[model samples]
Target: MPIIGMCIDLVAPSLPAIGQSFSVAASVAKSVISLYLLGFAFGNFLSGFLIDSYGRQKIIRLSLLGFIVASLMPIYLHSITWLLFARILQGLTIGAVSVTLRSICADVLPPERLTKLGPWFGTMWGIGPVIGPVIGGYLQVYFGWQAGFYFFAIITLIAFIVVFIVVPETHFNRHPLRIVSIKNNITEILKNHVFIGITALMGLSYALMILFNVSGPFLIQTTLHYSPIFFGHIALYLGVVFVLATFLGRYLLKAHTVEKIWLIAINVSLLVGIIAVIVSYFFKDSVILTTLITALMFISCGVVFPISLGKGLSLFRHIAGTATAVMYLVNISISSIVAYFAGFVDMTSLVPLAWMYLFLVFVIAILYWTVLRKS
Candidate 1:
């Protein structure tokens, strides 16, 4: 599921081609990135509602179906606007895939196993982005950008079949769907500070992540004039670092709980931020240095994602669908909005956005100690 979480990241390199096809400005191309995030936010919530109203398995089926179809069909549409429309649909389906997968993980994994399995989820997460761009870049360079979509479509088709055949119904409650219960259920979960704060943290963390993710291709390929394949390799390097960090985080968590791990994430994120800012100042023009800085920033994400998510949503097992969807939506929405605003900047300079990420974490840390220490 986390691998699928990466489908868009893989598509990042194709943004320039998309711009040329659409005849829009580079910043406008960035909105192709933003529109997807917006769709993700909306779809996350919609996915939850579907799960509540229908069932988890059914919703999963629907999302995968749409994902595969959208991937296959949208490439033929030439206008960037039309492509953006397709990407939006892709994001929507992917949201369902993420929300349902997380809800299931929250359901199936016991607290004991969650500690170990938590990081594996992050590990899988780290793995996805690594491959997404490498594959996307190859498709774009050798075949053209349209091949990227077809590639994802084929992957989705396979996943859809596997999911349908093996995934079980997880609702536990066999009762007919009740809209009021689903609505009230969301309200109940939101009332909890632990839930809101942790989820809010996910939002902010992802916002930082998307800023880097969305900007990477431009920063690497356009600014540095690296080949798409070369930038993809850089992404691969970053993913390798992230995968190792996630495993290390999981191993450490054998001796720690979610709170302790979150603190670790905070400390690492601070370092990552400081390093990123310094790198942006000194080596923003050097693709290698910038990649390393960005990769380091993502190292903390592997830790933050699982800890915050597992800790935040654990108490809401009864409303896992609504809770998980809401969480994913908010997380991506904040990131997307931040990234959209980032398009305002000259791509040549990455300091403002990097500093913004650093500041968000610094504030979150201070608040954690002062108010939400228990978090």
Candidate 2:
């Protein structure tokens, strides 16, 4: 999971250098990130049925092999187009790894155990984003942009070896490998209002995270005129907020219902968005204030995601792979769309980010209060 998280954001600090190397603008370079997410969404959509048909171990090994090959493309080929292809492949493998892992957890653990352990999953996941850019920054300074991909290939190779040695096949219940069967399974899960609501909330929560991931580099580096190292440090700090919040949530889950924790997170996020709007408009690009407020939002998101994900998967333990895939498909897809449109927003001002945050929070409220509550 930490490797998956690392793969996703490791290139953030290198976007500008990549653009200069390719003789393109930052906007075009950003596509490398977005295209990877697009592939991840597709992979998540398809991996559900495939993992259920085949086995987790087989698919994961093959995906990691594919990921390694793809990671080597741009480093050797030296083309932005090739880099985009590599990112897509990375996303595909990441989706397979993430969905399969989640399903395995659901397969091995009961609902109560799953709930207790979810935050630990989230905390480890949070650690990757915390250190990825910092690592990427030093790599970029020492070796170059291609070095990041080299790191990915090597680390993923080790992961492949580790999985081959230690991980066992966890899928006990298998569905038919028919297209009709897969479609019907997916349709049945979607029809559950509780599943839909929680998944939607989960996706939107992740979109908030992606929004920051995509925009943060440009905002901190270009608009705010900060050094890449400084931006990396800021990212590390904000990422720590998320890790700590997940730990706090681990304690909260002992006594509180998941919904209660989720609602509290929502309220805190709402307050942060409101404060961000006021500060971004009046103070107008106060770096310290904006960064800290956005960190608070990430903290809220850190709490919401694990709880929502754990509960949603618990709702469909029989089809854990499909359910988990659908959940991530929604998350990566929405996050990609939100990140793409965010390019049009003025990075000089925090208003756009603040507005986006508030809008997502509003949707989360409706999903919870109107849909999940009744269901």
Best by lDDT: 2
Each model's lDDT comes to: 0.75, 0.81
Model 1 Cα lDDT, one tens digit per residue, 52-163: 5666798889999998877876666667667778878988988888788877776677655544565677777667777887887888899988888888888888888899
Model 1 per-residue lDDT at 296: 69
Write one digit per residue (lDDT tens) for candidate 2, span 1-375.
Answer: 787777756788787788899998777777777788888887887888888888798988888888899889998898888888888888987888888888778889998787677787888888888998788877777888888899989988999999999999988678879979888888989888788788788778877777777777787777888777777778788888888988888889888988788778887787777777777787657778767777887887888887777788887888888888887888778778877777566677677777887887777776777886676
The clash numbers for all candidates, in the given order, read 3, 0
Give me the runs in candidate 2 sitting further than 4 Å from their true place.
none
Clashes of 2: 0
**Reference-based TM-score of each model:** 0.92, 0.96
Alpha carbon lDDT of residue 174, candidate 2? 84
Write down the lDDT that model 1 would get: 0.75
